[model samples]
Target: MSSTNRRDFLRASAAAALSAAVPADLFAQSETAQSSPGAIWDSGSVRHLLPTVSDSRMLIKVSFTAPVEGEPRLHVGDLTVRGSMGDTRGEHWHFYATDLGPGRRYPLSLVGSNGRALCQPWELATFPGPDERPNRFRLLIYTCGGGHEVHKFLPTAVRNRLLRRGLSFQPDAMIANGDHVYWDLLAPVGSRLLGAAPEAVKAAGTFDRSAIVLGSDNETVLKRAAGPQIVPVYGTDFRSTPVFFLQDDHDYFDNDEATDEVVTFPPSYFMLQLARATQGIYYPEFLPDSARPLGLPWSSGRDRAWGVSESFGTLRFGRLAEILLYDVRRTQTMAGPSAVYIDPAVEKWLKARTAATEVAHVVHVPSNPPGWTAGKWGEWYPDVLGREGKLTTNEPKPYWQPGWLKQHDRLIEAMAAVKGRAPLVISGDLHAIAIGRMLRSGRLDLKDNPVNVVLSGPLGSRPGPLGWPSGRRGTGAMPSAHLDMEEQVKPIEQHGFTVADFTREKIVLRLFKWDIKTQPVEAIDTLQPFHTAELTRPA
Candidate 1:
């Protein structure tokens, strides 16, 4: 054959062979994997691995490089958001895939409108489907983002330890029970008052919201390590593993007082606004009016007085389990203790979800402890006090009036009424790990209606009291006396996180403690069953 003809013949033969060797679907994926400059993903700019709603459908979040020039596109299996150029860029954008069942990993690829590949397409996780009874499941629980108790900032080493351990533990979900950010004291003043006398600690701010709320510079007093530092530690890579967030007193400005621009040390309007903005930005949430005319952000709305709203609702992963996340921070007000601590709508929501029959268990997440503590248990948050002429100081002094005490009484009544499932109560704020059976006010047999209280937290660090590296426990009033319960006012000396595993027969809790004296302790010492517990449906 002629030279030109022979070459053409050989090229055609090679092309045909290549096509025959590769699968059509594989070839198509490779073709689309190529990106154009108009659409790119900046992975380093990617943060916040949030699993919003995981069920038959999965809603995942992704953040892009600042000045995100174009819309971000997501591609996974048959799911794609090609024309869905969402309004948010350089910020957060959520997209979902329907018909996705639970308990499996789905491979995904994300690209910004600019064509930057966010991360080499990876597998995103999904919870177990309702019909399937997965033999086991797991979750990690944590609180207190302060690094070294004394350091009180994004302790990089500490965050690394948490990240490493969480990855190693392989929890199906992670619940940041409360106090993810300690914005109680803003900037300069906060630095000076890290662990000042209880009376002097406050939520004072400089009003330049950007500096402390989102900045990772630990030097700033309100440097919310949860944002710049801790979020990165978790990263968008864990998008498959759902992460849930809850707010406590610290997250709401000071320790517990929710505010509308008050004169007290805790609830400054600007600080609340900052917390609202920051909370909405960092976490994945089901906002106030999700079905409004357009997409509304979490914690804010044109309809609200201060553009702030609620973050309490129910999350279910099939019929296996359901969670009720309560908004204790926003529900509070300077309106005296007799006022409502939970929005009526939220309370209604909680009561209804607790009655769901499909789930094997119901978990209640209230930022503050439900059981009573001794004199001045939750003083920092300002829940039981009012801002009227009757009380002058914001400190947790003898400021609690009858009205405040009455409000707490209301909480007790509400807790007493919660039934249907043997409930699991997980709380933070005490800065220690403590667990005991909760007996309702008039019940003696905890076996039938026992309220198991599990305390988990201090992921970063926080000093307990004077001259002590850990917090000294304060005794509190028991919820009920008729039942077998421990009225624990014991001091908690350890600092760490809890990893919980759920099996068909029982749910197990493994408490991992760290050395408060060290930033990132080389080893994670497992505490005994005292910090752990196992439970099954009451017989």
Candidate 2:
């Protein structure tokens, strides 16, 4: 059958299954009625499941009702954490539990308004410290472009490949860097989308729309199921793997671009809120109970008016190395139509954290180097401010504005000051794979300073057949780029993820790619290694 026909058939099959699973009473209720408190109790898909921090913590967030109102009480096995209810743009309930540990698992259930079981119990687990005997941590990162659509075959293909590779190949977490769903199809001209829309509108417009556009026939069934099923299936593929989700531009709107007047949108924000409520894989639930309430203090009148304080945080693997995850996108400041600046607070945080830790490695998600370039940082070029309080318009046109340059300089200097501490950067915005070294002086001097930047593309998303032509190192149709290196790291069109194995001797990073299919395909393609060299700090 043609690809379109095959997709249609699959959608029909999924729709039938969803219809059978949903209780008839649910179909009869008005959209508002279905969202009312106690209404979710009737949902087979809706469960009072909370993503736990670790094996010891009792605190958990219960997700069931739509736009979860005032905090609810949570009981996990023998433990309990009283939830402090807040809303992410008055859309979904934001819950928090301050006390929790690392490396543990717990079973959690919810207590309804009447103190009875409202839904089935679910389990959550915490990440282990860096030193904890090298437990396998599977992280799946993917990117979304305007043309790309989520396909059942994509997920199915990923599951099959991992299955063939065995449990060892299963991922511990998943990151949807951005564009989790396409919203340009839903928007008309320039009116912004807010996250605080009624739950029904969100379901019909965003979730259901994405389902149809993505060709998921079970979209309605998945939508009616109450909680999201995609992440659960991926998690279930393994014996309950924890997921860490990150949103990119697509998740918020058609692209990451937002006017200074309006910051957040409804579709992306609503999707995020729902992801949190349902423990969807697209949203990171494995973060410590401490990381709950993840958003900025800013109060813009936008649906997804929430932002992570500083996307940069340290995850210590015992005493091995501190994993610094930076949210480069959120810290940017836009002024007029000319430049963007990184908030001073984030800059201070990055500098201070790097200086304080003796970590052997530093990992950045958006690994594009400082200075502007095409497709990557150039899109936001006007926002980058210069040191002299103006925009930089030097020849070759910097990829970023002045403000961005300052922030980039601060990060690079801080990392360099670490005195030979090997920094490994992993990025996924580009939908292609490559490996290169980051240098302070644009020169490829290995001795002075060296940082490994790995650009790994989509895990399962369809990246059309067109590939970048050879010799066109940094600029091309493919979504991959890296700092100038001795040997140019060319972009490779493939569908898969990258695995970084850090040992005492050296860090081994591997790229794994496969075709989309239910059955496993043999012969996975692997990439060559790029070693990290030792650097010397100035006295």
TM-score of each: 0.69, 0.59
lDDT per residue (tens digit) for residues 1-539 in model 1: 58565434322311110111222132123212321211222244565546554555555555445535566777755678542222223455656566665555666666667665554454555665666656556777777653323344435555655555554444567777666665445423333454232432332224353554433332233332335434654555355556777766666545432234323333466556555655545565542222121222234455222222345644555566666666565654445545455655555556555655666666777776654332232432222222442222344443333443444334434443455555677776656566676664332334446666766756655433521222222232233222245634243545667776665555776665665666334444222223556677645
Question: lDDT tens digits, residues 245-326, model 2?
Answer: 4444444333333343434332344444343333231233333313223332221113221222223333444444345454
Question: In model 2, where is the ten-residue run with the lowest total lDDT?
Answer: 13-22
lDDT score for residue 50 of model 1: 61
Clashes of 1: 34
lDDT per prediction?
A: 0.50, 0.39
What shift in Å separates residue 400 of candidate 1 from its native position after superposition?
3.5
